[model samples]
Target: MTQTPVSKAPVFGAPPRPASDVSAAVGLAGLAGLMVWVAICRAWPEIGAALNLPGPRERLAGSSAAVLALVFSGTPMVLWSLLVDKVHLRPSTGIDWSAPRPLRAVTDGAMTKLAGLWATWGLIAFVYCLARWYWRGPYVFAMDLLEQAAPLLFLGAIPYVLWLDRVLVEPRDGAWHFGAMLIGREAYDREQVWHHLRAWSVKGFFCAFMISILPGGFGAVVEADWSRLGADPVAWSNAAISAMFMIDVQIAMVGYLLTMKPLDAQIRTANPFLAGWVAALICYPPFVLMGGGGVLDYHQNTAEWTYWLAGHPALLWLWGGIMVVLTGIYAWATVAFGLRFSNLTWRGVVTNGPYAWTRHPAYLSKNLFWWLATLPFLVTTHSLVDAVRNTVILGIVSGVYFWRAKTEERHLLAADPKYRAYHAWMGENGPVTRRLAALENALVGRRRGAGEGVVREGGAGEESGQGDRHPAQ
Candidate 1:
């Protein structure tokens, strides 16, 4: 039998395939994936439409992006794989150098991102207001108006910065790799993730404050707003937006567990907090970048904001509530499905908690959860504008994620051999079986042994843990 590289975290037992030879893999995968898609279209037009068929223009753009991405990323992965194959490169090869990630897209990423950390347009308005206030007791301006126009400016920055960073900086990154690569993130070590998480925690706090506090601060400062902060629709809307942002954070923290594999175990057992911090840190940087740009600017400036603002209370309030609830379910399933920690592969699920019943409660839960995530923004949105934005940002991204998951599922099914049986027992409803099994697991755990927890592993009277096997009769 062939042996795979021993990863720091336990995986669901991959067949020890070599890491993609970045360049060749991309060339192969892209050609293969496209050919497969073409055949699918020829064979199954219904499925093609179901995948949200893109227009000619969008298809061209996407295909170009995919090709460029394949080259940029595939080259590196291919190089690394060759290095491993030829030299047997060890995991310890990555430099441990600690450098600050300067927010400068072009500057060495080791420096702090001081210049572009805050939304420039909003900052200009804010700073201008502050300057006026210092000179004159207070000033008046439709600050929110400036915010409305900022999205276009912000969205434009992504491609530009990605280019600047990769071209000028020492780091060879992409959008997926901070933008240098159009696909897949290089896995970092446990310590690297921890430090990154610390950075993320600091930034997340600032972001939460920006979302929740900025509106209140602005409202209190405005002469009309000062008299009735709550009365102002924009102020109320801001509060709601901020609240939802935090709620989303909590949801994402748990939501990530759905995609986690077995290796996440080390995080759970060795250091959960650190693992969580890393996950949140990496996952949320995209939002932070958006925040720095005051992501909603484009919508606000172009009547889109006004339209959304006017309808936001109903749109966001109603749909946001539903999203929150579904997110809550996903969060619950995070633990219920044995999805928490480092899920490198399928082995993470076991006899414990939700695993006794359904195979992937979190999978379908996530399917619904992604839709819920979109609902909040949709509720506040009107027209095809909002629809298009959500389609690309949320829908497309989520769809890609699900597609990759199916691939991983296929790999797991092949690896475990018994996965089909387990899945059959669980049923396709996903959560239904897992929910019941989770309840039973809890009861069994409670009765079988005190608060120590239920028997998670397949072994009798023993909890399932990484590497723990089922007791032989």
Candidate 2:
């Protein structure tokens, strides 16, 4: 009797609805606002003098000014999301604005939530104090900024929490649960407390780094001599790349700072797995293992694309263009997140823009850019050993990123059914993901076939009494 073949259809439901939490127009609006502000800052020296403003004739390139740019960059997104997308009314916000509870009724829960939030901030501050890296180099700016904002944040939380609790469908959220655990006044879910800590940890860790690096790139782009770049391919490409980085950093910092439930941008869950944290933290400073002289440093004795392709004008132009495009894709990945971008957290499932083509476009483009731009295999020292070592080390670095992507998938797949559907859809339909899956399947088939052939040959030898065996047997 013949048996019927099982169906190979995906178990994951229909592809997630095309709707995304944040719209493309919302991000584009923020981009427009940021560009307008950047232009004004670049021309501020002249404009301030023209208006007889009380300041020196210099562009606003200070760290404080860059922080202000975060405001400019974020405000338009908030406005667009509210005015256009009406995200505040979304059911995901867990808000029922139609019938706000009496202030007295929610006052207790609000206080508990605030307690959890403040304690979390205090703990993060303690960690910052203990970490020596927070007080040195670029982190000094972050420290300074936080010091100034700490009081404001404490003062602001009271009203925000109180107001939010009145409309919250479930006021005893993760923060409230954490507060309950701390106060020992009410029953609380340990998992909720754990999730609360993880979310804040992601925000605290990434936000500081984002703020510390913000002013440098913003200043570079604001102070760039655009007139001189037109004739120099290297300068032109670098300028473009710098601008892209500025966009990414500025917009991403805003996302980290503004995870308000009212905006429908609250972190759903921080990546819960320890492996996820390990994979992510090692790529950032103070824990980065890929820095110069570090264990995973892959840039030792390497010559960059510009150096190797120096005399070839056409090739230099082509290579530079490729790098710039890759950098743009990386930036686009961040911008596509709108107000939902952050590391090791799920704000929402974004399925539009570059994300539609591939789930990990940013990681893919980033690793590719490093390979093409650094040319790690082509060492300046001209030693075969150095070349081989650099290439292998870089491969390991890429593997770390692959690890990160997988861990993120594990977290998201567990947290959201939408992500599961999107994952399955991408595996079956995404241009990049489908091709890569096919290649992987093909390789696995070849290996299995090769192993089976070897087993058959061994069996034949044993049957013919030619197989290796002990003489005693």
Candidate 3:
């Protein structure tokens, strides 16, 4: 798992969030400004008309737009400030300081390659759109494709730019170099970067898949005339919930794809637990794609969504609010990971954002929501014992997630000392661990009782009880 080291480097550095970079500044500022604009647009009508927004529907949309603006604009500046000011990373070059000619040529070559690829792709996309316009009535335009493709295109393009820079600077044996190519001053293993590239690509594709499906869902919501909010408020709330979840997914996918800095070395290898793999597989699409029975379907467990609760306005609002907050926290945790986000592996030990307060914010919030939403304790059967059994079965699913958390810790602890240190810190400082310890003791006591009962049921003699009893007894 050792990465190949880059040789012969001395390039000058530039800040990623330079004040002089007008285009970058404007782009980010524009996004933030647009959010403010949207907030004005949505809020103005309500303010001017004094419209009532009591239910979850309109309130959810308004809140989402406001939050998205902060996420899009604020996150980048914060991350940039951290990298530049806190990390204090500087750019360096491999070429000798005197080799100005080689540097110019290398830069020219890399730029030329990038320009050529982009132009070729642009031309092809344009032609495709043109053909579609002529042959099919009201065809999709280049702008439409660009709108959808921009974020993904950036994800792929940035990596290529970094890879090209690497290639130019650290040429293969006998490869030509124009001048010294600039890269991060810190030494990063070539193989690790390659792994990151592969990981990001895979994750990006998955994100793309998620992003692609969301528009259709939104389209369906829009067509349904959400403003009416007529018959079923639960349905409206569900749509809003789905929309918020989709937006969260979009942010995470986009951020994860974009955040790999060329010099940000992969700190550790991915060593996932078998339990994590199994638990994740049972829950996500891979299992369903493989035609495994949807053994862990949420819909099935959510039989707890009773007709009584659904009809009660107060209950609906309460449940809806809880669900929104839980999902929001889950999404926020992913956002906190920023570029280090990955599935089934500890990409990096994030101690910022939601991670600053709690280690498993996503898992904790999500499982709590599952328990509330499923209401397993309320589920019923003609046989009282059967009802309890069913509730226990549903409860076990959430328990599996607890096992996942432990497995994650073990895997991460093996990968880096940071995770081990993080675990120790959590043990000392985390609020949830104490509650868990108390619950564990309670469960242990109950289990001992059950085991003792089983021994009695098996017709063990008094002598057997003497052997099994506590030493004090």
Best by TM-score: 2
| Model 1: residues with Cα > 4 Å off, grouped in runs | 1-317, 337-340, 350-393, 428-473
**What C-alpha lDDT values do all the predictions have?**
0.33, 0.80, 0.44
Ranking by TM-score: 2, 3, 1
Pick by lDDT: 1 or 3, better one: 3
What's the true lDDT of residue 410 in model 3? 50
For model 1, what is the alpha-carbon lDDT of residue 215? 30
TM-score, candidate 3, is 0.55
Model 2: lDDT to the true structure: 0.80
Comparing 1 and 2 on TM-score, the stronger one: 2
CA lDDT for candidate 3? 0.44
The estimated TM-scores of all candidates read 0.29, 0.90, 0.55
- Worst lDDT run of 10 residues, candidate 3, spans 464-473
lDDT of each residue in 1-473, candidate 1, tens digit only:
65432211112332222221112232233233333432332333355457766544122222223223223322332333345333213222221223324445445331122122233334344554554332322112223323553576466645544443443323431111222121223442444434333333342333322232223332222212223545455555444444333222322222232221111211211112333233323323233322323432222212323344455566645555555454444433332322122232232233233343233444445556554443424434356675566445554444433443334334333333244333333332234443434554575564321212222243222221111111000
Taking every candidate in turn, the Cα RMSD to the unseen true structure, in Å, is 23.7, 10.6, 14.9
Q: What would the per-residue lDDT of candidate 2 be over residues 1-473, giving only the tens digit for each residue? A: 64322222222453443345567787788888899999999999899989999969999887777888988989999999998899999888999999999999999999999999999999999999999999999999999989999999999999999999999999998999999999999999999999899999999999999989999999999999999988789989999999999999998898999899999999888888899899999999989999989999998899789999998888878899999998998888888888888888988877667666666888888889989988988988899999999999988988888788777776766666566555556666556665655565576563211221012221211000100100000
